[model samples]
Target: MLQVLSSESAQEILSTLTSDPGTASEIANSVDQSVQNVSYHLDRLCEADLITPTKTWYSQKGREMTVYALATERLVVQFSDSTD
Candidate 1:
């Protein structure tokens, strides 16, 4: 979980999923990345249970696609102000 989140690409993929669920192809387009790259991170997020397949999108060619959405509503990260 922490490992995946530490990745910039994974973070970008997660940000896109936060808005709504999408297939790897869709996310790749939105993030301006290759489908292969997006698909890889999606697998990581799924393994971490951070995202899940919520729906399906079928193409005109009859290919079924899995759509992923955020399993967790929010993620907060804060840094301590202490100089020590």
Candidate 2:
């Protein structure tokens, strides 16, 4: 997980999504990035199995929209204690 989070963009996206599940467009808004750019980063995260997208319906402008949620299972925390 640490290795996967090493990427700055990935880390930012993950952090935002972790706070609240959102679609590629929403994430792009939160990160102030282009949708295509955000999607590219999301694809990498998905490939690393660090994030999962779930399909769901959302009402926007009186229209049902499909969106996604980041799977909490993808997050892993490691603890280490050492004096260097």
Candidate 3:
């Protein structure tokens, strides 16, 4: 999870979602990135459980689009010493 969060693109995607849930294309536009790049980050974010596909919408061309939103409004991270 930390590894995923460490990415700058991932962080930007998360920030974009905070204001409004959107499809990969919309996120890419907001972050000034390519759709493929944003999609890759979105997949990682989904795997890390940081975001989720809230709904599905169809484009005018009959393409399926998934809207993503943050899984939680807030996140808290804590570190613990493994060696005791």
Highest lDDT model number: 3
Sum up the clashes in candidate 1.
0
- Ten-residue region with minimum lDDT total, candidate 1: 75-84
lDDT of 2 at 76: 55
What does candidate 3's lDDT look like per residue over 2-46, in tens digits?
999999999999999999999999999999999999999999999
Q: After superposition, how far is residue 13 of candidate 2 from its true place, in Å?
A: 0.5
Tell me the spans in candidate 1 whose CA falls farther than 4 Å from its real position: 76-84
Q: Residue 64 in model 3: shift from native, Å?
A: 0.6
Q: TM-score of every model?
A: 0.86, 0.68, 0.94
Better of 1 and 2 by lDDT: 1
Residue runs of model 3 more than 4 Å from their true location after superposition: 81-84
Error of 3 at 10 (Å): 0.2
User: What C-alpha lDDT does candidate 3 achieve relative to the native structure?
Assistant: 0.98
Write model 2 residue lDDT over 1-84, tens digit each, in one string: 566668888888988877777878789899899989888888888887777777765666665533545666465576777862
